[model samples]
Target chain A: MGEFDLIARYFTRPPRPGGPTLLGVGDDCALVQPSPGHALAISSDMLVEGRHFLSTVAPDRLGHKALAVNLSDLAACGATPLAFTLALALPRADPQWLEPFSRGLLALADAHGCELIGGDTTQGPLNLCITVFGEVPLQQGRSLALLRSGARVGDDLYVSGHLGDARLALEVFRGQLSVPAAVFDAARARMETPTPRVALGQALRGVATAAADISDGLVGDLGHILRRSGVGACIEAEAALSVIAARDALDAEQALGFVLAGGDDYELVFTAPPDARAAVQAASAHSQTPVTRIGRIEADAGWRLVDAQGRALQRQDQAFDHFK
Target chain B: MGEFDLIARYFTRPPRPGGPTLLGVGDDCALVQPSPGHALAISSDMLVEGRHFLSTVAPDRLGHKALAVNLSDLAACGATPLAFTLALALPRADPQWLEPFSRGLLALADAHGCELIGGDTTQGPLNLCITVFGEVPLQQGRSLALLRSGARVGDDLYVSGHLGDARLALEVFRGQLSVPAAVFDAARARMETPTPRVALGQALRGVATAAADISDGLVGDLGHILRRSGVGACIEAEAALSVIAARDALDAEQALGFVLAGGDDYELVFTAPPDARAAVQAASAHSQTPVTRIGRIEADAGWRLVDAQGRALQRQDQAFDHFK
Candidate 1:
């Protein structure tokens, strides 16, 4: 089938029957009416082969990761996803691949309640760019957008979930690691299917002062907060490795190293006011996500990694760089 | 530099002062407040190396085309360009390439009155996607969106500008065509820098019943209008080739073929009711754009290509299809 025909058959949806929305799909442009009380949040991300993912990665996994990463960005900013448009560049029209990829994408999109409103399909090497739109209330103090520049001195730093699962998954994929099939499967799943902390982000909207998803490792990402907020952090090495210890993924020393420097975690790292520590604790228990207070922010010049004995460890700034 | 550092140095713009917008670059997602009386129009386009352009294509032109194609989609819907986000996938981080690209993109964006809000920069093999936002009045008849499905029986069909320049330019690029340096330069400009019919689209909003930008050639694209509107058309070969005839890009007979079957013209084509014909003529005259009546929509099922003498000629259903 032709590109137009394929789009019409699977993608087009009738305009939402309502007051504000006008068009949805199957038009040159999708028409939307902004809600009276909210501002529209727009973000776009592009994933390409040999860079974002390997050529041998499964199509379904690629689709899931593509959407998940974008959603994670919204999660970082405390935005609720509403709709998205995709621009797909494929080497050829392979229905078998398209079906699973679209299904995986649609499944996640449905789960998140985001409408796949519009997109474009073209011929090229595998590349997918997704632009997501979300909403945040506009009233002052009502809609607090999380920024990397909001960290306060002496505020405790926290990270959600475990780190380095995705890194391990990549190692497995590259044949640099050997493990049981189940372990391999679990690790691979973590890399392929990221869980965007959307609900956590919303819950922390008014609570956390600074936040960002860990796409490029904890140390490097936290550095953004420090540089932007004009503060520094002293992280407790043992506390950072708690997850790796519980999962038996690595020894305490190795886990600490990985958690601080591994990329593709897609977990939130945020800061709260020292007074909001009780609220942060309550949120951690209530939200059913692990939140570890790894360190305290300081009015200083650079981040410092401290051991249990309070000795600072000299470390290199190891983080993911797209160009690197 | 690392990704974070690169983003800090580039793609980081503070919120603009007193613009018709909300949120700027540097944030996780851009927040946009559409004009009070307008409905938001969105369109996206993806350009990939080896498919959309040669690897040697100037970075500036590549950036321009990435945004222009998306703007063309907005133009097709008779929307006013407002803001755009780019998702660039690059094989490597070269500051030289990025500076020129950003300059070109910002140049067009500034000229078109669009703000550079937000986007992603990722490592990949030369893939670019741009999503553009435009505004159109929501009032029913005052700001009608032109769709591909509004042609009716006896409605005149027309297209703007010459055809085949882009394809001819490609021929020259591939060393198949030997043309004068001046002509070659002109054709190359058309190929690399397409003039989207934004103004003409705005003018046609209230005057034309149906419309679309000619991207995938006349025959294939007109087929879209026919399929969606459930109508057929009879083309007067001589009349449809009139604009190209003036250009003398090809002989009258050859120009007729290119005008009907060639692709990437990025010109406006629309159908008008008989009663609205004079108004269209007047609008065209005031806008300094000629509105040619090339053919009429029919109530039948098939497109018939006919000479001025009314003799039908066999035509092939050949046009650009990404997945064909």
Candidate 2:
């Protein structure tokens, strides 16, 4: 089938009733009305075949992950999901591939109330690019944007859900490590279909001082917040190690490394003032997403890891860099 | 440089002083505010190396064309450009290529007041995907969207600027044809940097009944309007032949083929009531974009071409299909 035919059969859907979307697919452009008194949040992410995923990945999972990553960005900004566009380039149009891919994509979109707007499908190497649009209250009063630059000294740093499982799954996929079947299955789920903490982000809208999604490891991603906020951080290594799902499966050193620098967790790492600790806990409870206080923002210059006794710890791991 | 560094050096810029952009680069997501009473118009396009352009095309031109194509989609909908996000995957980080590419991209963006909001950079085979946002008035009273389905049974069909020059340039690049140096230069300019009819589209907002951008040749793209509007059209072959820049350079058959099915013109093919001829002419003059009246919409079902003597012309040339 031709490109247009393929899109019509798989990706096109009727516009859902009562939302921002005015016109959906099949037009030169999709029309959407932003929620009144809200600013639109936009983000784009691209995933290349071999670089971003293994060839053995299911098309359905790849589709989910593609949109999930972009939504993760929206979550970091504490925005409500509105809609998204997908630009997909495939080497060939196979029904087996297109069907499951669209099903996975639409399922996630429906779950988040994010509609497929408009995109182009082309014939080339496998690449999926998604641009998501969302909305956030404009009059939040005091810049409740959850900006990377908002963390102040002495704020408590918290992370939603567990970490390091996605990286553990990667290690198993690479044949670098082995684990029990149940552990492997859990890690594999985390790696393939990450749950973007959208509700938690919106719940923490005015609660978190600064926030970022853990894509390139907690230490690296939190470092971005520190640099932007012009502050330092002290991450308790023991607290971090306790949050790793595979902590018992690996040695302390390896588990610590994965917990600090392993990537693809898609959980929110946020900061809040000590005075707002109760409110932060309430947000976690409201969203039903677990939170772990693992660090504190510092007035000093760079990030440092500390043990339970407050002694500095040494580490030799780096965040994932596409070009590196 | 790493992916972030590459983006910081090339694509990132301080948010422009005044526009819809509330926040730009360096964040997980960018923020924009739509006009108070307008709906957002969104579209995306992907350019894959080898499939979309030759490796020999200048990086600068490639950058301009990448965003230009998406802008063309906005123009087709009578929307004013607002901002855009770019998702790029490159084979390697080379300053020599990025410098010119950014210059070309930002130049066009500035020309249309479109800001670079947020995007991702990755290492892979070269691919550029752009999603552009635009705005159109929500209360135009009579569907001033210029939708492809709004054409009436009796309307004058019009097209902006010249056609077939890009295809001529492609043929020259493929070594299938040759032209004078001056002619070649002009065709190359049209092929590499065809002007999107943005102003003309806005000018025709209320004047034209329906419109579409001519991307995949006149006939094929016009076929989209026909199918969407549930109507047909008959083109005056002589009038179409008159608008092709290389009409005198090739045989009648070859010239007709290019004019009918040559893609990448980036011009607008629109329809308006015969009674609105004066308003259409005024729009053309106001936008300073030359236009040609080539045919009329019909009540019947398929498109046909007639010679100066009203004799039906026969030719076989399909539009450029990515899969085919």
Candidate 3:
């Protein structure tokens, strides 16, 4: 199929009745209603083959992960998914790929009540870019969207959802590590179909002082929170190590490394006042997402990894830098 | 530099005071305030190496054209530019390319008063995907955003700015055509930085019945309007042939093919009732954009190319289709 035909066949749909989309696909631009008393939270992510995903990945999984990564950004900001535009460039139009990809993409979008509004499709190298629009409710005089700058000294730091499995999956894929079939299957699933903590983000809006999605490893992503908030942190390595879902399949060092510096974890690392502990727990419970307190915000300006005995182990401010 | 450092050095800026952005760039998602009573017009365009643009084009021009294409969509919808998010994938973080690219991009953004809110930068094949947000005024419960479906029978079809030069430039680049030094330079400039008619689009808000940006040639992009509006059109061959800016550089047949089927014009094709000719002319004059009335919407169902004597010539619905 041609460019327009591909878009029409796989992406275009009638806008839902009374939906936020006043004008959708087939127009030069799509018109979407911005919710009153709310700010629009926007984020864009582009996934490229061999860099963002492996060539062996199923198209359906690639589609799911593409939207999932962008949704993770909205979840980090406590925004409700509203709509998204996809700009896709393919080497060629293949029905086998488009059919499953659209099905997987639309299924997740439907589950979140997020509409696929409009986008551009063309023939080029395989690249999928999604720009997501979400609504972040604004309170009387302030935006309630959780920000990395909201963390304060003495605030408790917590992480939601299991970590390290996605990285473990990568290690396995690279033939760097060997694991049982069950463990490999679970890790692969975590890598391919991460669950964005959207509900948990909304629940923690007023509860968490600061939030950031952990895509670029705990150390690197949490450093963003620290740098923005002008605060430091010390995480008990044992606490982090305990949260690695695939810990049983690896050594202590592997677990610690993957949990601390492994990228591709779409969990939320957040901070909350000690007094809001109960609320944080309630939010975690309400969202059905598990949480573990790993550390506390400090007055200083760097991250320290401490052992169970309170001895400093490693100090790191590194993430997976594409250039480096 | 690493991803974050690259972003901070080139892309990050302080939010404009009292601007639409509440949060920008550093966060996982940027928060923007939407104009009350107005619908947000959104469009995305992606440029891939050797596809949307040539590898030999200067980085600065690439940046300008990248954002220009998206702004063209907003212009077609009569939306006022607000902000945009850019998602870029680069082969590497080279300061040489980035410096000029960011400079050109931000320069045009500043000219349009559009903020660079947030985006993603990654390591991959050179790809740039930009999502632009614009605002269309709401009037008496109706969006003033021009839509392709609004055209009616007896409406005069108008085209804004120049045409064919970009295609001529392409032909010269491919060694398929030869032209004088001045002609080649002029055509190259038109190909590289054809201005988006944003001011004219906004001025035609209630005046024009329908509008579309010409990206995929006049025949293809105009076909979009016709199909959406359920109308046909008849264009005088002499009129379209007259608007070719580089006509002096080529034969009549070459000029016709380039004007009718050349893509990447970045101009607007619009329609309005013949009685509103005065308003259309006033808008064109007010915006300082020259427009030529080349066709008229008809009761019939397909576009016809007719000669000066009203003799039907070519009945074409052809446009560049990458996959075809």
Candidate 4:
């Protein structure tokens, strides 16, 4: 089939009634009715072969990761996932590849209530781009969009879930790391299926003032919040001791290095008002996701890592850089 | 500099407040409040290296063409241009490349009063996708969207501007054609700089029903209108004789062939009801654009060409298709 015919067969659609999708795909333009009493949040990400993913990666995983990354951005913003548009560039129309790719994309989109709206498919090298839109109640003012600039001095810093599995998954794929079968499976799952903390984000709406997803490592992402909010941070070296203790092979020092510098955790790192510690605890309870108080916001301009004795620890920032 | 820093220095901006900008850039989402009583028109296009352009094409031209093609779609929909978002993927952080590219995109965006809104920049192989939004009047029972499904049997078929120069320019670039400096200049200009018929699109809002831009040759693009409208067309070959007369060293047959099958013209091909012919004429006069009466729609399912003698003329459909 031709490119246009394939698009019509697989992607042409309209929004279902009684859902987040006011208008689905299939037209020259999709009519979107923003949810009443909510502001829209939008983000776009593109993945290219040899850049974002290896050609050997499964089509299903590629599709899942494409949507997952965008969803993670929504998690950072505390927005309800709404819809997305996909633009695909392929070397040729391979139905075998397209079928599983579509299945994987639809599966995640269905689970998240993110309707696959409009898209364009054409012949080119493999490049996948997805633009996603979400909604947040506007009545709460800046509560919906958790800005990177809201962290105040003396505020507590927190991170949800573990880190470094994604980067380590890449190492496994590249044959640089060998592990037990169970550990390998866990790492692969983490790499292929990133669980975006959307629930945690929504719960943190009114509780956490500054938030960002750890796509570029906790240190780099938190640095964004610090720079934007004009504040510093003091991260406790022993805050994630449980994650370090759970490690069977890696040491606390090495795991701490990854927690701070490893990328692609798809977890929320946020700062809450000092007086709202109880609310922050309550918010994490709502998500049923573990919230680790890793650090505190400070008045200085430099980020510091301190031991229990209050001695500073020298650390290197190894955030993911696409061009690097 | 890093890729993130490069974007911050160049593309990270909201449009300055003025003109048609309801909301500019710089946030998680760009807010756009169109003029009251106007329905928004939106379209998107993605251009990939080695597929949409040669590697040697100027970066500025690539930026201009990316936005221009989407603008042409809005123009076909009878919308006034408003704002655009660019999703750019690059192989590396090259400052020299980005400066000119942003300048070109901003120049066109400024000239058309279309603001540059929020977008993403990342490292990948060269892939650039642009999504543009425009606005048109909203009136109950009054059609403003120039749909592809409104053509009727006995309705007139018309096209704005001349054709074939763009395809000829490609041939010239490939060293397959040699001509005088003047003809070469005309053809090259048609390829390098396309003028989207925005004025004509606005004027045709009330005058025409079915409309589309000619990107994939006259016959192939018209076929889209025919398929959507459920009608056929009978073209008067003599009607396009003027385009042939304007060319040198080419017979009528060659010129007609080029006009029918050559792509990238970016002109509007539309149909109007017999009763709206006067309005179409008035629109043509107002815009100072050439609107030719080319054919009439038919109840049959296929388009046919008839010469001055009323005899069928055989022409091959040779529209450009990235994947055939």
Candidate 5:
């Protein structure tokens, strides 16, 4: 089939009912209007076959993960999902793959009320890139889109939902470790389809001081927030250990390693003042995504690992970098 | 070098002065505030090596063409330039290539008053995907962004700037044809740096009834407008022959072929009612872009080509298709 036919049969859909998309696919460009008194939050992510996903992955899961990663950026900014465009390069147009892939992609989009507005597809090496657009409210003329620069000294550092499971799954995939079948399956699922935590991000909108999604391990992703905010932080091992969701089959050291430096965790790492602790907890409960206090923002310039008693310690975490 | 360091060294520039981007590169997501009463027009295009351009082309030209093609889409919609996101994958992090590549990309962005708000870079095969955002005005309850669905029977078809030079250059690249030194150089330049008619697109805004960009050759791209508008068209061969900007190097048949079916023109093919011919000419003059009336919208459902004597003729023009 031609490129146009491939898109029409598989990807084209009417814009979401009453959604921000004024016009969707089939045009030279898609036209969307952000709500009045709001700004558009945009993010772009590119995923290559071997770099971001294994060749063995199911197409549906790959589709879900592709959009999920971009959504995580929107989640970090506490923006409500609006729509996304996908630019895909494939070796060929295989119907068996396209069927489930679109199903998985649109399914998550529907769950988040995000519309698949427009995109391009071509025959080439397998690569997927998604650029997501979201809306953030304006507060007294200031956009409420959270940035990593808003953290202040002595603010309580928090992380939403769980982390480490996805990284642990990678270890198993690499044959560095093995786990029980159930644990392995669950960890693989986490790796393949990590939740985006969009609701939690929105709930913490005005309540949290600063935020970032944990994609390249807790310490590394947290480093982004610290560098942008020009502050340091301290992570307590005990608190961080509790943030690992798939720890039933792993020992304490392995779990700590995964929690500290393992990448692919799509949870939010945020900061809020001590006085807003109650408010933070309220947002957590409201969004139904658990929040953990694992670190504290500091006036110093570099992060540190601490024990349960708050004594500084050495680390085993290594953040993921595409070009190292 | 790591990914973050690479981005920091080469790509982390601030948003344009007084531009719409409230927050730019450093954040998890870029935040841009569109003017009130305007909608954002977004387009995404992917370029894979060996498919979109030759490997021998300079990095700077490739960079310019990447953004230029996307801008062509915005022009088709009559959208004003805005901030864009770039998602790139490279085989390696070579500064030698990146330095010149970024220079070409940003130079065009500055010229158009468009900002490179944010993007992602990863290690993979060479690929560039750009998601561009533009703004279109609203009139009453309707958006002024032109659509392919708006073409009506009896509308006069128009095209902005020139066409077919890019296709002629491709023929030379494939060793299917040869030309004089000056002709080859001019055609190659047109192929590499085809201008995006942004000003002309915006000027034609309310004047043009329907529009589309010529990427997959004139016939193929115009076919899109015809299908979307549920109307047919008739191309006058004589008027089309005038669109061959690089025709000095070729015979009449070859020039007509390139003009009729050559892809990568990056020009606007649009329609205006007969009564609005003066307005169309005014827009062309105002934007300093020449336009040619080559065809007319028809009541039927398929297109036809007629000779200068107004008689139907056989053809040799064939549109470019990736799969075919």
Candidate 6:
């Protein structure tokens, strides 16, 4: 089928009557209505073949990860999914590839009540670009928006879910490491379909001072929150290492490196007032997503990792730099 | 600079207080507050190196056209520009290229009051994916949104601005034709930096029954409107030829082919009631964009081109298809 025909047959769907979407695909533009008194949260992300994923990766998994990464951005801002547009450039019109990709993409979208509103398909190297729109309700006499610059000194730093599994999967894929078959499967799933903490993020509204989604490793991503908030952090090495799913699978040194600097973890790293610890725990319980306090926001100007004995640990790895 | 630093230096901007944008760059997601009681119009377009434009094209013009094509989609829906996100992939971080690109992009955005909200910058083959957000106000108790399916039998079909110049420029670039230096320059400008016709579209809101932007040529794009509206049209060949800026430079048949089936025009082709002709004219006058009555919508299900004496014109070229 041609580009337009392919979209019409697979991606286009009738807009749900009385839904936020007034118009969907098959037009010059898609129309949506933002809920009254709510601000729309928008983010865009692009994934290129080789750079973002392997050619042998399942199309469905690739599709899921593509949208999930963008949704993770919204999650960091405490917004609920609304709709998204996918601009896909494919080498050819292969139904085998297209079907599974759309299935994986829409399945996740359906789970979050996010609809595929509109997009464009073209001929090029395999590249997926998604722009997701979300709704953030106004609360507490201000928009209940979590920002990178909102973290304060003395705030307790927390992270959602286990870290390092996705990176472990990458190491396996790169043939640099080997793991038990079951462990590899679990880690691969984490890499392919890392869940966006949307529910937990919404629950943290009015609770967390600042938040960010971990994509480029915990330390590097957290550094964004620190740089923006003008705060420092002292991460408890043991606490951080405990959150790695493969903590017991690797040596202490290797575990520490992956826990702190391994990337592709879509968990939430946030901070809240020390007094709101119970409230933060309640949010975690409500969302059913595990949370652990790993560090403290500080007035000092740089971040460091400290061992259980309170000695600073040597840093070895840097964040993934796309341009580098 | 790295990807993040490149974004911060070139595209990031401070949010305007009390503007529609609640939060701009530097956040996980940009937050925008759509005007109350209006529907958001969103569209995405991607431009890839070698496929969409020549590498020799000016970076500034390339940037303007990238966003302009998306804005043209909004214009087709009669929506006012609001904000846009740019996801750009480049081979390397070259400040010389980025400065002009962002300058051109932001200048057009600033012209239409659209803000650069948020996006991603990565290292890869040069590609630009832009998702633009627009607002369409409700009118006459309905959303006042224009749709391709809204055309009716006997409606007067109109086109905004001149046509075929962009195609002519492409021909020259491909070494298929030559023109006077002045004509080449004008046509190249049209090809590289075609205006989106935003004002004209907003003005035709209540007057036009349906609208679409001419991107892939007059016949092919209007075919989309016809297919969706379940209507047909007989375009006047003489009138179509008249709109080609390079008409005098080519044979009648060649000019007709370019005017009817050439791509990259970026003009608006809309249908309106016969009684709304004056209103359409007024809209054109108000927007300072020319409008030409080129045909009439019909109940039949196929399109045709007729000469001034009412003889059917022979079809020559097909619309530009990316894959084919």
Best model per DockQ: 3
* Candidate 3 local lDDT, residue B221: 86
Local accuracy of candidate 2 as per-residue lDDT tens digits, B133-200: 99898884222466888888999999999999888999999999999988888989888877888999
lDDT of 4 by residue, A114-170 (tens): 888776777887888887777777663323577677889879999888777766667
Task: Give the B-chain TM-score of model 5.
Answer: 0.97
> Which of the two, 3 or 6, has more TM-score?
3
Q: Could you give candidate 3's per-residue lDDT for residues A1-324 as a string of tens digits?
A: 888889889999988887788877889999988777989999999998887889999988888899999999999999999999999998899999999999889888988888899988888889999999999988884799999999999999999988889999999999999999999999999999899999999999889999999998998999899999999998998899888888898998888889988888899999999999999999999999999999899998989988889899965446888888
User: What's the TM for model 6?
Assistant: 0.98
| Residue runs of model 1 more than 4 Å from their true location after superposition | A19-21, A140-143, A179-181, A245-247, A281-287, B1-10, B140-143, B245-249, B285-288
Against the reference, the lDDT scores of all candidates come to: 0.79, 0.89, 0.91, 0.77, 0.90, 0.90
Expressed as tens digits, the lDDT of each residue in B1-324 for candidate 4 is 775677678776655654444334444445455565565555667888876777887778767778788788888888888777788888787878888788878788778888777667777778898777777775762336787778998899999988778777777788977767778788777776777888898899878878889888888888888988999998888786555323674567766877888788888889998898999999988878889999899999978899988898887766677668
Query: TM-score winner among the candidates?
Result: 3
* DockQ, ranked from best to worst: 3, 2, 5, 6, 1, 4
Docking class of 1: medium
Can you give the lDDT of residue A266 in candidate 5? 87
Expressed as tens digits, the lDDT of each residue in A145-195 for candidate 6 is 889989999999999998988889899999999988888899899999999
lDDT of 6 by residue, B1-324 (tens): 887889889998886676788888878899888777888999999888777889999999998999999999999999999899999888899999999999999999999989999998877888899999999996643577778989999999899998899989999999999999999999999999999999998998989999999998898899999999999998998888889887889999888888888899999999999999899999999999999999999999878989889898778566777756
Q: Is candidate 1 or candidate 2 better by lDDT?
A: 2
List candidate 6 segments past 4 Å from native: none
Better of 1 and 2 by DockQ: 2
Q: What is the lDDT of residue B152 in candidate 2?
A: 84
User: Which regions of candidate 2 fall more than 4 Å away from where they truly are?
Assistant: A140-144, B140-143
Docking class of 3: high
Q: What's the CA error at residue A269 for candidate 4, in Å? A: 2.2
lDDT leaderboard ranking: 3, 5, 6, 2, 1, 4
What is candidate 3's lDDT per residue for B1-324, written digit by digit as tens?
889889999999988988888988999999888778888999999988888899999989988999999999999999999999999999999999999999989999998999999999999989999999999988875799999998999999999988888989998999999999999999899898778899999999999999999999998888899999999999888999888888877898889888888989999999999999999999999999999999899989878899999899965547888789
| Model 5: per-residue Cα lDDT over A25-92, one tens digit each | 89999999999899999999999988888999999999899999999999999999999999999898
